[model samples]
Target chain A: MEENIKFLRSGILAPIKKWGTHWSLWPVHLVTACCGAELAHAFASGYDGERIGALNYGIARQTNLIIVEGAITRKMARVLRITWEQMPDPKFVIIMGTCGLNGGVFWNSYHLVKPFEVVPVNYFIPGCPSTPEALLRGIRQLQNEIRTGEPRSSIEFEKVDLGKGKMMPVTPKSPKKISLAPSIVVNVPRKADEETKKLADEISKLGLATTVTGKNRIALRVEKDELVDAAKKLQNFGFDHVKNVNVIDVPNEDKFIVEYHLGSYSKRELMPVVLNLFTELPRSEPKLKSLAKIFPSADYMEREMHDFFGVVFEGNEWMGRKFLLAPDTPEYPLKKDFKLEEEKYLR
Target chain B: MEALVISHQKQIGDKMLEGLISGLFKIFTSNMMNIPLIEPLVDYLMQIPLVNLLVALILWRPFFAVIILPGLVGLLIYLLWIVYWERKLTARVQWRVGPIEVARPIRGAIQALADGIRYFFQEAIIHREAHKIYYIQLPILAFIPILLPLLFIPAGNVVGIKTPYGIQLIVAFIALIPLFIVAMGWASHSRFAYIGSLREAFMYFAYEIPFIIAVVAMIYVYGSGDPYVAVEKQNIPGAVLNPLAFIVYIIAMIMATSRLPFEIPEADQEIAFGPFVEYSGILFGLVMTLLYEKLYLMALLFVILFLGGWEGFYVGILGDFCAPLVLFIKTVVVISVLVIVRSVYARYRLDQAIRLGWTSYLTLSIAALILGMFVGVLV
Candidate 1:
């Protein structure tokens, strides 16, 4: 008799429970690394996140859930914290992939940070680059929480006490001088190979000064006005994509070296070419023309460089303030003479 | 003669009571009889005049069909099936197998269940800046309006309710969704929420007219305000009879539900989840359901307007219940088609989406209306 009653109640209530469980789980649009590509795939065709109610929203403030993809660098930490605090309460966090849990391959890197330390996470999905399936699972977990008003897990943190120890105030030490050669040097032939020389000659024929730094490597010192034309020439030469846009700060020289690393996704013959464009600016009021207008992909990289080096992009008036880095950090820490420890004490 | 009549009536009553008692006893003793003892207890208690009257009043045909039964079983099953289909479809397109690990044998049908269990144990994060009451109330409130359109949606002959102006009623209810979305955004009290709310408001205007116009064109051609009658008239299927209206309706459906090419308000890369940015746990879940609810309502409209609702085979069982089977099949087909489109296309830019809705879709729908009228006259 009792068993029959249980069955009857379940028959009546099960549908209600299912209905409540099906409609929730709003995923935040926070992409931390390459796993974001897979995240997009999960929400995109075939695996449409919409069917499960994991609609991807643009701003963190209005979104109640966050899917922290792979890596959350120290630079993204502040944004994560602010975004979490900005959202209305009763929000859920799904740390997608192993990188978010323990930093993955970048675990020991200085830049990577654990996402849970900054936000109260609800779900931890295990995957290198989590497939869309994993993401949907995480969302379903969130929905279950809604049906049964119970907390998924407790937020645990270890608080260390230093009150028992004696402390002494001490002057900060200067930053150690690490050899820059490791980063600067390239394993290039001292003399240009025949193919590189021919390319250099062809580049010069375009009425531009060309310097062959190494085999298959060419540098063009173009005027600010001619940078766009130089980029077009390189594109015609089959250097199809921009690999990296780097800005080198030289405070004493009152100038910054802005370089665009151009390479090719097509053409085997032009495979070895690494086109470099360098332009200098006055150090006192450093500003350079934005290349973002020419290459749409350069937009984010330029913003990143501006955040680290404080070199403003003149034509890119809309370049928002510090992207990856915190706004409170004193001076561009990457500058040669800047000391991070001293600045911390001084502030 | 009067005494004989009274005795006969009393004997009949006694026999009926005996039959009921025997039936109750059989329910408990027989192996095939799965009815529980509690059911008899409840039935005995329900014999009270007041409670029985209340039960009878609320269990009216429309309420039972729309809010009680479909809201429970039909909605849940549909959500689960649609979710599974979406994942499998997207996985095929993106070269992956989605959620197979959770339920390996069944291809992760229980994946959603596992997720729900996990969510039950998770913490809810409520922010300080939020308007405490309104923020909490909006998601719950939004659901009322979201579910309202279901009443007018005919599932074959098994409609929840029959209203004269069914199309107008459904459109009006669906139109209230954006307002609640704005309420959710505003109650969150955050910058992104503010921006997202504004976007929702803007998008609401952009798609509203075109969507309604398409519906109007169909109503004009069908010459009926009732969805059930409108669908019945489409003996050749609305899509075949009026291909132009079909295309316009499909595009308008995409815009209304904020699907790809028109997912502007909730542009994940630009504004985040928009109005739902602050929702978490169950609340977030409610916000998520809002989209599906919208989709389900839109799917119903599509079935009635183009696909021919509840117009297919009947196996002749359960009378009215079986009547809705055709409509359910049609809705499922429509949803599958909508979900499949996600794999074939990327989201259009906001400007492009608005332009398409206003210029191209609007013009096409108007042209369809004229054509429909011309055909009506010729026929």
Candidate 2:
């Protein structure tokens, strides 16, 4: 990489190469997220990024730079790496938006991957979605970096001494760190109004462990074999559809908690109720009866849950094959015990 | 006696060599260019021996025709200007400044030069799946047809390989260029390239018939395939004589070169520059300019057939050089005007372009052909 830079800087043709590359920084259009809109505006008439000779090209093979628009998830991270590899040498990367920097709102999210980790970024335009002017300014800075062999910040900050003030300095708060082992209690009993309590009491009479978890919310626990029977009884009792199917991996407890949040669109009186039917399965062989037949909307969500936690849904045809993730992604990535490569800190 | 004989043979060889040099010099000087703008410089340079030969070769009619005006040098100038002009014009239509920061004073006039330099220095990746030999060879080889047409295309008396069938030969050579493009696609061995080459092959048939008929119509109107005779016959320009052929030829030029309205083969958005998706660095620069070079060749032929082939006002001092200058300027102007279609018009779908070419465009060319036959007899 240094050799490539050296070749661009040291030869008799260096000036021409530098000048040409400086002016012709055609960024390949890799619109990963919302920041792509801002990139468009930069090149559009408002900001006119082309005035600085940064045209947005389509293919990776032909362009010299990549303006990574926003968040790069684990799946798109591979795509970002492949695109970076496909481009010819002496390429630069300008990461746009805070999601690409350190995952802004998606910070520490299971799926979010910092684009900086996937590719060597030359510049970062820090914003929720970097503005059009900031994008063009980033391009200008890249051009300047090409002209001069150094990466200099376009705007320099003026320093003022804090020690000159007499008042005590406010200490900064420590950053939040997520717990290694999270305590997940899905069926916690809670105080509820009469209607929800009556619903919970009526659900318990059907031979299932039921608790009122909140107002208008009831949690039902059933053994793996009894789940289908419980689903059928709830279906007849006005629960018409499955709002979501989720899986929680508990490595310490050595079990997978599968939950189905059921709702009713057919019955107006039952519309406000959210019945979360859950079952626990051993980690070694986590299998469950699919609720897809009882609630048809659960079909795709069941497949997604199977993809994430490797929980086999017996009646789901889409099970046993990868779904909702790229083919090369590590299997059962959402499993708590499935370790991701930790981000390294450089001091 | 042996020594004398050897010396005598040496003298004869030297005499022959000197005679050959003088004879070649005589030929070069006899048809030398008469540019009054450079008359004093040429007169001064003629006092030197080797410089005079070099200068004579540069100004010699045939050499000048092939290497300078309306040829390689003119093509280079046209490439730079047209690329920059097209981008700038498109930017204006888009309500933006295209590339002004490169050289702020010139409004980035040398933008193409910078891009060409960058392409030249960048890595030319010959991927593993490619037909290594053909992949490397095709772009350079493609220039054969491009340059060959220049040799046969005459500008008044200054010409290379001046033949009676100059127009037909040019048309034939221009037709040969697309085969190289399709071959480039085959050598690429990628999906996009495969689709792109298939589109190119379809478009080849789509436009080539009408294009040929259009040229044939002009040939019929002129009553000869020779450019000189075609020019002499055009007391009223050929466009005025056969307007239908003129329109057909212009559309054919657009389709043949894959200009915007018919830019199906390498629609960058749909197929990622289609056949050229795999190309990078200098290889891409060469292939990218291939269509532009084709445009230049077609425009030169367009000038010869319809625009009266260098029948502009003759400058007395410029002499033989004036004709090529006029031809080149006219070709460039035609191309410059044609490039606006890129910004103004959207690309046609492959099916739409082929339908237009086969049905409506074909009909127009046939109409022009019949009109040309009538005009040929009348003239």
Candidate 3:
């Protein structure tokens, strides 16, 4: 079997085999991230990867190539490995976008794994979302490599030296610390408009302090203990669903500000309204009353917050399981204390 | 007495061998494909020893029909042509050049061959859960029902086996195709394959009745199950004579082959090729072509019933061979037109397809039966 395959692979019949393999480079459709949109663009009418014989086929068994689209969160990394392992022999992997290379904008993300760690990569296409042309060019390069047995990169990196013979520093210099997180105010005081006045008047009946944060944005803060009762009042006030769950870490205050952005889907006039319910939890305990049952839509958002903030939603059964992150992912990656290895080039 | 019996047996064996040899000569001369274009070379080749037998077997009407045109050779060429043409046509409609990079000058005409070779060389994986023997056997086994129809499909003066109930036999064979597909899905033992197999069974029930009724309607119009008699009766093409049947046949054709709007069983988006989810390498390749082969057979039957099979302007040079060529060309054209369906429509939901198959197609097929009867009486 070995001898026959060798004969087909690199012996007398290698050219024929190469020709076939080149034209039949079907990539398994395993969209890992946002780059999949651009990958779709590459395969769609505008670019048409089929013209070059790289059809985006479904199922790992039928495909011979894997085009890792972009960022692979830690959870997706496991899936990526399994899919790669399932693919038949003589398979190729092409990781597209800077996210897969060094995580790009998510460079120090707590829940991300480089695709190379999951599977052996044959090529890397760099861009946040690489252009369709770049993607096709990558396939063309792969075809050439198959025919010639030469591992050629689609791009060439030219070296640039700016120091002009100056000696290297003995110790690597540290960048000035500049955090990019926006300064968030959970309760910003503002004058109420007619709509806000109506909303505030109704919310004030609940006996909770309400503030007009912005147009269609209301901030209602309550003690952690009263969160359930305040949410029940708001639920009765016609906030149909939870739009978002947010947590702001304040290490100096030794507190975690947990907020649920609620919105109305049923009441048409209240469609534009987004009511933020804010509560402060002690950093040590970091636990809150679960609002999953209060608003059915909050169940998943609550789980995601549970994954990111390590905030235990008391009644949510999924609090312990990893929903959005890999089981092995670092705890509370979004917290202020969870510093990613300090960015050497950060300014 | 024993010595006399042994001598008599030897004599009988010798005579039997002689009769077979003489029979071959008679068969060759009597039914050879009389190609006027290649008459001189044919005559010259007939005078040779071993080569003459080959020429004789190839030119013999039944053998020619079964092994040459409208059979193995025709199927092979159609398989290659359809794959490339489908991609090219879909790309054109989608506003893109397709398959041109491989063999750039010929516009990647050999793209399928390249893929076939790659599939041949790649490993055929049998996952742990798969029923190994059945998984290995099913792809090859599925071809039996598909190829069995060719024996009954008459082309001009050449036919493999001319049964009076030819159309019915072909339909019976066509129905067997879905059974093998169902078995394949069961053998695969994968979740997607299991879902795919169940969908295949549902689709089989959905489309088979309308498709059978459509064919039966055509038979009623012709007043015979024999394709040759149907072809002879068509002074007017069946498509024009009984248009309701023609329309039903076209719709049933799409549904039967699982073309777009009806590609539910092997929906890549939903079930990842359904029954073929676990197929890899050449095994995948074999199963992939199953639908195309089914489409070819259906088109052959469709042409005989509606599109005027072998009724084109006859080529004098090709003689009896011309009919099969005409039929083959018509079937190819029919299938080429089907490529538009892929780009024009998205797949329908299972419930939607079932509703259509049960309600619309079934009602139309019944209407076609009524029309065929009225047209038959008038003619």
Candidate 4:
């Protein structure tokens, strides 16, 4: 009698829970591409999904459901993983459309990455662009799942063992080939563009050494002694933001080329202007001046380049590897002879 | 006695033949004259081509005067008035100028037209993934069926098509809309499209039965399927005679057009315009027009069913056009009432909409039918 009574109670409470879940399934809006426009409409005046209690909020810290629209490229993969990690537990991911499922029309494209591999998904809604009604149905299904606490179904794939009973074959690393030629070759000329030449003449009057490479391309080879003052001069001339902080390793030349690509969003003209600053260091102790004292945004980019290229920044305390790339990746992948396939195969 | 009987029979036969010939003649003449009137105009305008096209645009001057101009211009003006009225009425019901922005001058009358123009020039982008051809075609195709319903809709005594079973014919043609909507979804070739199409199909099933039943109840009450006679029978207006049917029919009409609370297929935020996700530019313009066209048809039906067709208290100075003007005014009022519901309430969920259609609305319609039968017995 007690068992039957308990069973009856469970059944009665089940539907109540189901209805509550159905009424409150909030979907997170993570806009990626053009499909974001249609997604916006699903919540707008004509359809009005807000009546069902699905609201859009920006921060991932609060939202529980992630609606991944489509295309997650390699660069975006890092962002996706980091975002997923940032969200609190009990978060659900709803992969919308065929593209979100397996990259859809963009399948086999180099830039596309599978979202399912990055985050555990609750529901996969099938459609090139699923209708609002269909999306509602998917939401309803998700609500049903939450109430029931059903384990989601997984895709089936067979795995094969390549090495059958025998020890895995190992390959030896090929001998390293070295060239005696200097890798750090600088092309310096006195002639420059009108604006750069005027700026160069002013710098020359200040008794500063500057090399003009090409028209408008002024390479200021600032030593550690005068680095700060030179950066200040460039900053005054409207080279505000740092675009790319590059670090090149030149073992043959016994030095490292630390280049700071600077630019500014001009308020007067509403345009971006780029300027470059380069300085070389000994390869044995490759330490260069830090630009963190000048452009703040350059601080992160310089630290990132330092981590990958193994270049050192003198007086920069935050030189430790940040989370941009995986720590386990062997050597800098951007280097001339760093074969990614060989590294993976060796591993 | 034989000669007298033969003469009477001949008189009856002559009158019957004359009526048939005259009906056919009117149909042909009306249809044929429209071509000549438009052709000479088209040719004379085409001769000057570029300059004439720029200045005396065919769609602009006379054609606008005839078909589109009056309805569109009137609709634009009416939309504003209706929006204001709706806001005021709903605000009174909810107790809130509804619109206080332009209330200081024109009393917020030009608000809807301002919004319409804003939407007209708004940038509509077609996404890369959408099926390009069908995504563009559906909105334009939707207008055809919407306009077709207008042909059979009668306003007072002024009707585009006068038929024995005009109301039945209009209802039949309007029913074909869901199939076209489904076609639209399938053509767009999006998941949202498929889902929206399915929702539309489901909605059709839910509302079509009760809507047809309500119409049948009205036909039974009036003893004629002809809209003109039906309107004549409702001298006191159908709403007063059978309030139950009126309520049920209104609900069904709302469901049919996917109006507020039942607008499941095109839920904006959830499916992102659903089947029309890929549509942009002029195609989206058509889709927007399609909704107004639907509202126009329903408003016409509402005027015919509840407000007594073109029956107004006064025949204004417009004379024969007065009836049509009255009918137009009543239809516009109905449309305003219908559209104002949008700003006030949000949409209902799919399951809830279905339940409403099946249980509440279905029961209401059946009860209305029963009430009509009781009234029939008493009369």
After superposition, which runs of candidate 3 have C-alpha atoms over 4 Å from their true positions? A164-246, A258-306, A311-323, A342-347, B1-30
The regions of model 4 sitting more than 4 angstroms off are A1-347, B1-131, B376-379
| CAPRI grade of model 3 | medium
Q: Model 1, residue B223: what's the lDDT?
A: 78
lDDT of 4 by residue, A1-347 (tens): 57854553366554543343344444666667655666676665556554444556454433446777767766677777766654443357877788878778876554466888888888887777766665656665676676567754433458966675565566556544445655565536756667766755665666666666666566667675566777787777666777888877676776777788766686342133345677777766766667787888778887788757767676667775643655545555554444443222343
lDDT of 3 at B69: 86
TM-score, every prediction: 0.57, 0.85, 0.86, 0.45
Candidate that scores best on DockQ: 2
Q: Please name the candidate that would achieve the greatest TM-score relative to the true structure.
A: 3
TM-score of chain A of 3: 0.81
- Cα lDDT computed for each candidate against the true fold: 0.70, 0.89, 0.88, 0.64
lDDT, candidate 3, at B228: 88
Candidates 3 and 4: which is better by DockQ? 3
Per-model interface RMSD values are 8.3, 1.1, 1.2, 17.9
Model 2: per-residue lDDT, tens digit, B25-119? 89999998878978999999998987888998899988889899888999999999999999999999999989888889989898899898888
Chain A: TM-score in each candidate? 0.48, 0.71, 0.81, 0.52
Cα-based lDDT at residue B88, candidate 2 = 94
lDDT of 3 at A340: 72
Candidate 1: Cα lDDT at B342: 66
lDDT of 3 by residue, A120-228 (tens): 9998888888888988898899998998889888677899765735645454555434355664577887766788778777888889898888778888999999999
**Candidate 3 vs 4: which has more TM-score:** 3
Model 3 lDDT per residue over B1-379, tens place: 9999999999999999878877887887788887889889989998997688788889998888877889989999999999998888888887888887888989989888988888877788999999999999999999899888999999988898989999999999999999999999999998999999999999988889988998998899999999988999999999999898898888878888889889999999899999999999999999999999999999999999998888997878777778999999999999999867988999998889889889988999999999999988877
User: CA shift at A57, candidate 4, in angstroms?
Assistant: 14
